[model samples]
Target: MSQKPTSSENIVNQKYDRCLADLLVKTGVGFSIGVVASVIAFRRRAWPVAFTTGIGSGIAWADCDRLFNPTRGPGVRIVSQAQTPESK
Candidate 1:
């Protein structure tokens, strides 16, 4: 039989959900900007500018998520310290 999740697991799950929501928001903002920029560039007949702007927007959006998330990405770390016999 499967055991129920503990409090720590619940906290981790909540953090993951929050992070996912934040990422979704970031993605939406980036996609919206990309669409607007692409439309303007297309109207101006600037195909290269439109293409690059769309790609860059997507990349920047993902980067924001990676840079800001503390529970995931490069932010995960562990620290350890040794105790002297006297201290113990």
Candidate 2:
């Protein structure tokens, strides 16, 4: 029989509170970088270039977010862990 996860694991899987904070911090760094680079590119009359730069940065930096929460990330899934129903 599979042992049930303690409150800690459920908390990790369900709420993703810690994971969110961690990702926000990690992603926020690169996000700032992206914003700055995008702004610079836009100032150079390269809107498409600026927009794509941020998208690329977001895709690349998103791995850090997956490192914290895999199954619950908005639309990105870099990890392959199976998501299970919350056991009562």
Candidate 3:
């Protein structure tokens, strides 16, 4: 009952995957930097600096949730009518 995706769908999926992967990689780097900055700030006992750094770190980590979501990534617009029930 199920059929293979058309060439366009395959291309769209590939593009989405690539975009998602890039977003995750970039977000991970940002989060790593934030963590390092927070650690350095806390170690120096700079309360104000540490607080700001920790806040930035939390924001960075929060953004990771979007990077993990499928519909959030940039890619082709798949029309509903073209999608099979299984694919949808």
- Give the TM-score of each candidate: 0.46, 0.33, 0.40
Please name the candidate that would achieve the greatest TM-score relative to the true structure. 1
Tell me the deviation in Å of residue 43 in model 3: 5.7
TM-score of model 1 vs. true structure: 0.46
Q: For residues 1-88, could you state the per-residue lDDT of candidate 2 as single tens digits?
A: 9987688777657546655565566555655655676677555445545555556556545754665557767886564346655569
lDDT of 1 by residue, 1-88 (tens): 9987679777768766766676666556655665676677556455545565556557655665665564566657655565434463
Which pairs in model 3 have colliding backbones? none
Q: By summed lDDT, which 10 consecutive residues of candidate 2 come out lowest?
A: 44-53
Whole-model lDDT for model 1 versus the true structure? Answer: 0.62
Compared with the true structure, all predictions reach lDDT values of 0.62, 0.60, 0.60
Please identify which of the two predictions, 2 or 3, would achieve the higher TM-score against the true structure. 3
| RMSD, candidate 1, Å | 7.2
